[model samples]
Target chain A: MEILKKLKILADSAKYDVSCSSSGSKRTNQPGGLGNSASSGICHTWTADGRCISLLKILQSNNCVYNCSYCVNRVSNDLPRATLTPDELCELTINFYRRNYIEGLFLSTAIYSSPDHTMEMLLQTVKKLREEHNFHGYIHLKAIPGADNLLIEAAGKYVDRMSVNIELPSERGLRLLAPQKKREAIIKPMTFLTSNIAARKAERRKSRKAPSFVPAGQTTQLIVGATPDPDLQILKLSENMYKRFGLKRVYYSAYVPVSHHPHLPDISSPPLLREHRIYQADWLLRFYGFQADELLNEKNPNFTEDYDPKTDWALRNLDYFPVEINRADYEKLLRVPGIGVKSARKILTARRMHSLDFDDLKRIGITMKRAQYFITCKGKYSGQTAMEEHLLRPRLTLSPPKTAGPEQPSLFSFSSDVIAPEDAFSSVTGEI
Target chain B: MLDFVYDGSFNGLLTAIYEIYYRRQVPQQLLSSPGQTPKLFVREERIITDETKAGKVYEAIDTKISSRSLRHIYYAYLSEHMEAGIWIYHYLHLGWKLGNKLDLLLSDERVHRIHRLSQKVSMERHRLLGLLRFQLLRGNIYYAALEPDHNVVELLAPHFAARMAGQNWVIHDVSRDLAAVFNRKEWVATDFTLQHRLELLKEEEYYQQLWQEYYNSMAISSRINPRLQKRCMPQRYWKHLVELS
Candidate 1:
């Protein structure tokens, strides 16, 4: 078949994978290669639906042998399936790279024929690019769930980044949604990679000659809202993956309704806002010094629809706020609802030069409206008189609608009505 | 009042600043090029740059201000600020009064403008490090060119050297008529009166054809949005962008 005709069918089928990030790989040009891979950063270009199409985001083939209920590319779907030869894909990548159309390639595929068959084709494609074609640009390859360890390791050596989509949070969910896939198939490759990373590090420690192994590290994506898994369960799983596997990232994709299955919920699509909230919470867990337990529990299993995860946290832990601006440690300063890393650093830096006051906080660009309830500037409060949820909840919810723009009075007018930057700090729990 | 005329380089500006301050004479009119006349009734005295006088001025400013501040002053001079040369003189005067807190003057809108201008120049330097695309010509020489809005060509030198270490490459700022040439080991700037002899590559046309083919191949006709593409890659920049061009 013609390359363009085959590519369209394959890419269209591959679109539902929802793991198009080309970030977190850091490889540079070698002697014979024409390009390099940047670390954890891809020039992400998104479509109108906010789909990342920056890379040649495509599947090598869509001729699946396994029938997964949730997947549109399942064997039952009788779609116009096609596969590209390794040389065809390599030629296309070089052509595209020279034109500056893409930073790199994000290649994934369905289990065409078998897991080994799919992975072998992917391995050949990447191997040809690195060895024969001398194509040095970024490559993010997908590790087929049940692929052989040798094939998986071989795939890692050629590409900058790799991922094996968790597909579902739990094994129960996996069985119900994707019957052919197993928990061991997904976890084994991850465990092998985790051990491989350890072995590579040890090799490096013993001798300086050891080559880099998946320099960007492995990442996985879990389909949120697919199973009966709560956000708490998801976060717990995410936290464990970070601690256990040393995974670089755990991308959470809110499920998009792609099929009309009898068992699957008839929800149109997973709420985009919920997906956005999960990402916010995910960032809090990763960057902000918050643990999954700290953000959620049995009582607060899901993120609040109205307020962001951080704000939600700050409001629940109201007593922790009113943190002293000049005295608070970096971690404590970070916990303040409104204070971001940039602002916290500014506060720390500016305090060294001069003793900070309420006016000084404003000058340094702290969004006092949120921070006032949580922090104090020179023993003064600049937030609301009522830190109680009844008064604060309405004010917080009303604030977004009331003063969302330039037409409204300045949001800063609450300084006298409140007290100091301290009083503003604890007013809300803004995590994300 | 003394009027001093010097070359337009950063060192020339510093040497002129040194002359005025140490000589204990304020120039009513300072011109970069010779033969410029100031308004009538303003006394103009030309001060020739002397090594001793310049050194004393440099030492005093270095002691009063800071080495970091001095670098900022140099950056401001290179910024080609509209009234930057004159502003530097005023800033030095402010520093003399303000002691170590000379940066307090940075709060002023005029000084802020200089800082903003310098930041703009610095930001372009950072972005170009990742954004620059190099193409290999027929002669085995790599030619990468840019038209950045800031004077970031110098800042881009160190990064490209480390990244493209073994290769012979020419990074040319087309608008500035300056090129940073990395020949095997050493890198240096060249301002050629005649254009560079680097042969135009047939590789470009090859890449261009491939890129156009890829662009057509990737674009979903079912989900075409020229408006979104235009938003991400503006029409103004399309002529130089290898994909669009």
Candidate 2:
């Protein structure tokens, strides 16, 4: 294909990947380098959706040998196919980077010809940019599942971060939606990279000269709502990845219908609200400190559609409430509904100097509407106690209707109130 | 009742604080204006710019609270909130009472509110460093203008020179008409104007094209959340956004 035509085709194909965040990497421009990576997130561009676009996210090739049923670029799809030569791709990225159009590149592809061929082309493009063009900016390379270990290792050496998307949650789900890709193909590379990363980290601990391998670490994406796996199953897989594979993040892309399939539901679009809720739950896993089994099970595999994960947890475990604000441990303080990481940290830091009363807790910015039932500041409870053990649905429904806006429901409204008490507690504790 | 009115400048504000502290006459209201008439029962004070008084005020605040806290107070002033003056007064009072231990008052919503406003101001200033787009004018002076929510015009002075040190640049806050000028060697704040027929249209058009191209390339049509977009980059500021224009 001609260079310009090839560029458009590859760029359009690569646009589907949403995990283009250019954060968690800090690289200064080398002596002959052309770019810099900020520690904090930088906006290279703002999309119409108001999302920050930092990287020139594109695929090297959309020509796949494997047929992933959900993927539009899968081998079976009769789509126009194109692939950019390593030099052609490198030139495009460097020109864009130099012109201040993009911060770096997010290079991914379908299994073009074979995993090795696709991976080799990706490594060539990135290595050429680093060695020839001297481009030192952020590069997030998508490590192809079942690719040769050497290619994956080569990608790690040049790119700031690498991610191999798990695509589906369970091995069963993988078989149903994308038959060619097993759990092992994705997991094996993740396993290898994790060990490689650990070994590199160990070397760094001993000496300062150990070169960084994927300084931003590894992240994976899980397609939500495609299969029968519940949020619990998804979170379990995510938890295992975090604990065992040491994956930095497990992105949940709400399964947007790309192609018609017998096994998949004939829906207009993936449930975005469900996707958003899963993200919140995922945040609970990573930062808020929640566990998977604590959140869902075979009986209740999905999130409570009515309440947030934390609020649901809080309601389920109501006996834990009325923990004295002045004496509760940091973990206990974090469990109070409406109390966030910031407020919890503030409470922990403040109680060092003075005894906290109900007024003090309010002053510290606790949303008493939700936290009151769960906490007692110096043994003072300012919240309604009767609703403490009530299921979130009825209690949240009881808010006075004296004031209501057209767009925004009352803060306690199920649709509007995101950080439900139980959900909040679960996320905060990393409990299931 | 004593009322002290000062020019809307940090130095002038500091001078007023100095007079209040030195004179030991507590005011009924500390407004930031020059010519407003005080009530018949009130004592009025006109605040003129005095570097010595400003220094003394800075020193007193630094000794009482902390240099960092004083900087936050200045940041709070730049926040342009209607209650900024009151927040400053409360901040000063709180500083005197708690000293450096005031950060521990994180649970106090009032203190937290002021700190949040101060943080907002700082965040805006940092954002402008990345967002500010300069256009080369007729006089070889690279000019970028903004109507920032915060008083970021002053905050940008230290950065422009380091990045674009070779060229003369003028970053103007069009709403405030205050500009940060770097003359290749030294940088200072000035009230600069378009003295010549310098066409901003060509530069504006170039930026418009580039921004639109980037915007078009980046958006995932499936994930178009205009409401969320509007919440982040408000429609009020769309006139200045090259992409939207």
Candidate 3:
């Protein structure tokens, strides 16, 4: 087949993977090298789906041996299959990089023939990009499950970031949908990569020139809504993964239906809003000092679609509200419904010079519409007359004001405006 | 009321600030050349840009404030806001008195305005670094043109220099008629006019087609959101973008 035809099939197959970050590793171009990875990732462009295309996300081959029900590349799908030669992949990456189309390559492969063979092909492509092409740009490689420990380790040294996708949340879901992939097959490589990365860090501390091992860190993805796994169970598993294996991110891809299976949810599209809420709760877990249990529990298995996870948490624990803005510490300031990490930091830095009032808070980038009920400035409250949940809940749940007209251009707006806090969290966590 | 006017340059702005301090007079406004209409009792003074005076003020600021704050000042200057000259003056005034604590003085209107202005310019510069596209032209020179809201050509040049070290490239700010030309080893800024139209390399069209194809194939059709795409990459940037065009 022609290279472009293969590219279309392979890239289309890989679109569902959804991890597009090319960040957290600061590798500068060597004397004769062609590219470099920035510490903060750059989004080259936004696709029509409103997703950032940061990397050339493509699969080496879309011909799989395993029958994962949720996947498009599963063995029984009967879609057009295509694989690129290692040389073809390298040429595409270099050409795209030269044209400023992408930051680097996000190379994944299906279980073509066997796991070891697929991984070896991936390793050869990445190694060739780094060594022969002198490409020093960001490369995110997949740590193929059930691949040999030595193969995973050797590949880790060449790439900036690596991930082993835990496709389903629970072991039962894995068995029901993807019977070939055992829980151990996924977790074992993650554990091996984590320990090897730790050892490499220790080695680098002793010697400045020691080669890095997965410097951007490992991330994983879980297909939500495919099986009957509740939000609480999924989040708990994610929390445990973060603690145990030191994963940088856990992406939740709302299960987009591809195959007509009696066992799977009979939905045409993924439950994006649910995926978005999980991401919001995930952010609270990572940065906002909230535990998985705090966000959702056994009683409340799913987050409400009406309000964001943070707002929901704040409303439930009203005793924590009426926080004194002037005297509250950074942690307390962060718990407010409307305030984000950036706004919270702004408040911290600004409060040192002078006490902040409601007007001052607006100027400092706080979302006053939601933050008003939760905060007090200089012992004064500017919230509604009644602080009851019934009254405040309706106010917090109101949609954002609409733009003047559809064609009225917003010159200064950014990607943050496109994705709300929860949506931003979902996209960033998925990509990063 | 005195209106201090200077050449429209960062050094000129700094010199005006120095004059404000030296003369011990608070000006009604600081105007970049092409001063506004003068009132009966208002004095308009044309202050020439002096590198020595600008250097002295910058050195003092570097000593008193953090280098990060200095960058903020530079970026704020690039914003070219109507009141940026006055805002920077007020920021430096506080920086001198409070030293490094001026960054935390966000409640102060002047300091907050400058901080926000700096952020706007810096964010644009950062965004353009990724959004900027280059078309390979004849003579092996890659050329790109953008009309950013702020003056960020100089800010973006060093980044491309390091990333595309061995290549020849030119980033043209069509709005300001300024171009940053990077030869194989080094780069310099030059005043450019669109006198001649250059043809793209034959292979450029083929690669652009492939990129557009890849871009279209990658998006999930079920989740198409043009509103969000517009917000992330504004329509203003779409003219030069290969895939969008």
Candidate 4:
């Protein structure tokens, strides 16, 4: 097949992986290299689906030896399959890099042959891009789970980030969907690289010229809504992974129904809203001071589409409100519903001069509609309703304010009529 | 109300600010122009731009207040908003009065306005760094043309200088008739225009086609959201992107 035809098929096959971030790498161009990684990654463009296209996400080949039911590139699927030669792949990367089409390459593949052979192809292509082509750009290579540890370690030396998709949430799901792939095949490489990355980081910190290995660290993806896995189980696994594996991120790809296998759920569309909630919960665990059990317990096994996880937590824990915005410390302020990390920092900075009122809070970019119920400014509540759960629940769920309420007070007008003192007083009142 | 008319350069704006403090008079406007109308009963004065005075003022801000505040003033000035100069004058005036705690006064309208302007300008610069696409022209030169809302072409040059150090390229800001041309060794800003049509390499069209195909195939059909796409890559920037075209 022509390379153009191969590119379309390969990219279409790879799109289901859905971990296309190019951040957390500060790799600079070598003395004669062509490109570099921005400290805060750059998105070249957004696709029609509104996903950032930061990298040239394509497969080395779509020919597979395994039939994972949730995947589009499974063996039983009768679709056009193609592979790119290393030289062709390198040529496309350099040309695209010159034109600024992508931040770097995100190279994944189906198991074209045995796991060892497929990994060898990935390792060679990356080494060629780094050595012969003099390319110092960001690369995120997928580790063939059952491949040898030596091959995984060698490839880590040349790429910014590497990942092995924990294809299903649990062992039973993996056994039902993809019987050929072993769970140990995935966890073994993850454990190996985590140690290597830490060791290299410590060595580099001690000496300026020590060789670096996977300097951008590692990340992994989980297919949400694929198995009958509760969000509690998924989040607990993620929290454990973050601690045990030292993983950078745990991506959740809402199961897009690609196959009609009996083991898989019969869904018409991807569970996009459910995926979004999982990501929000993921962010809270990583950035905000929240634990998995705190956000979700046995009784509440899933996140609601009505409110975010933080707001849900606040609604359940009523005593936490109404937090005094001026007196709350940074950690306490972060727990409020509408105050994000950025908004929290802004409030702290702006409140140092004087206690902030509702007007100043709005200027500082707090989402007062949601936050007003959870917080108090100068010991005064400003929400549309009182701080009762029943009173505020519907208001929070229905986001828009009243369309035909009393007109917003004009900027020049006071809340109460501010009559002139001369007009209010009887100036010439003298008893006869 | 008093007004000062000076040349529309950053240094000139700084000189007008120096004159604002020299006369101890607060001006209602700082007009840099061939055509600007003053309010009724307002007096106008022409101010010459002095490099020495501008330097002294910049040095004082850098030394006394903070380098970060100085950077904020510079970024805000690049925004080229009509009232940016006057707002910056007020900010710096307050900076001198407040000493080191100037930026922390975010509740003050004048300081907040300047911060917003600086943030806007820097955000545009960051966006253009990613959105600007380079097309390969004849003679082995890479060219990109953009029309940003702010004067941000100069700010993008340093990043590309370190990025594509071995190649020759030009980043042209068609709206303002300016370009940053970088040779293999160094970069320089010069007046630039497209007098006639230019030519591209024979393979340029093929790569552009591949990119468009990749862009289309990457977006899953079930989740197409044009509004979010427009929000991230605004419609104003679609004119130059090959994939979008």
Best candidate (score: DockQ): 3
| Residue B140 lDDT (model 3) | 93
| TM-scores, all models, native as reference | 0.77, 0.84, 0.94, 0.94
Q: Report the TM-score of candidate 3, chain B only.
A: 0.95
* Displacement of the residue B38 alpha carbon in candidate 4, Å: 7.1
The DockQ values of the predictions, listed in order, are: 0.18, 0.30, 0.56, 0.50
Query: Which has the better TM-score: candidate 1, or candidate 3?
Result: 3
lDDT of 1 by residue, B1-245 (tens): 34566665555666777777567777754555554545465554444555665566567767987765666666676566556666777777776776566654433444455555666666555445545666777766667777777666677776666545566888887887878988767789887332546565775666655544544545433334455454443355444555444
Q: Which stretches of candidate 3 lie above 4 Å from their native place?
A: A400-432, B35-43
- The residue pairs in collision within model 3 are none
For model 1, residues A1-432, the per-residue Cα lDDT tens digits are 876677667767766665555566567677645666555454433343323355777788888888877777888886798888898898878756543456678888878777887889999999998899777778888988788999999888888778888878888888888887889888999999889978887897888677767766788998876677778888889898888999888877656666778756556435444555667777677767889999899997887655767778888888787799979988899888778777787687667656788877776557787777777878777775666766566555412323343433332121121122222112112232
Off by over 4 Å in 4: A398-432, B36-43
* DockQ of candidate 1 (2 decimals): 0.18
List of chain A TM-scores, every candidate: 0.88, 0.87, 0.93, 0.91
Best by lDDT: 3
Instruction: Measure candidate 4: CA RMSD.
Output: 10.4
Docking quality tier of candidate 4? medium
* lDDT (Cα atoms) of all candidates against the true structure: 0.68, 0.72, 0.85, 0.84
Tens-digit lDDT track of model 3 for A186-269: 999999989988999999999989999999999999888899999999999999989899999888887887889988987655
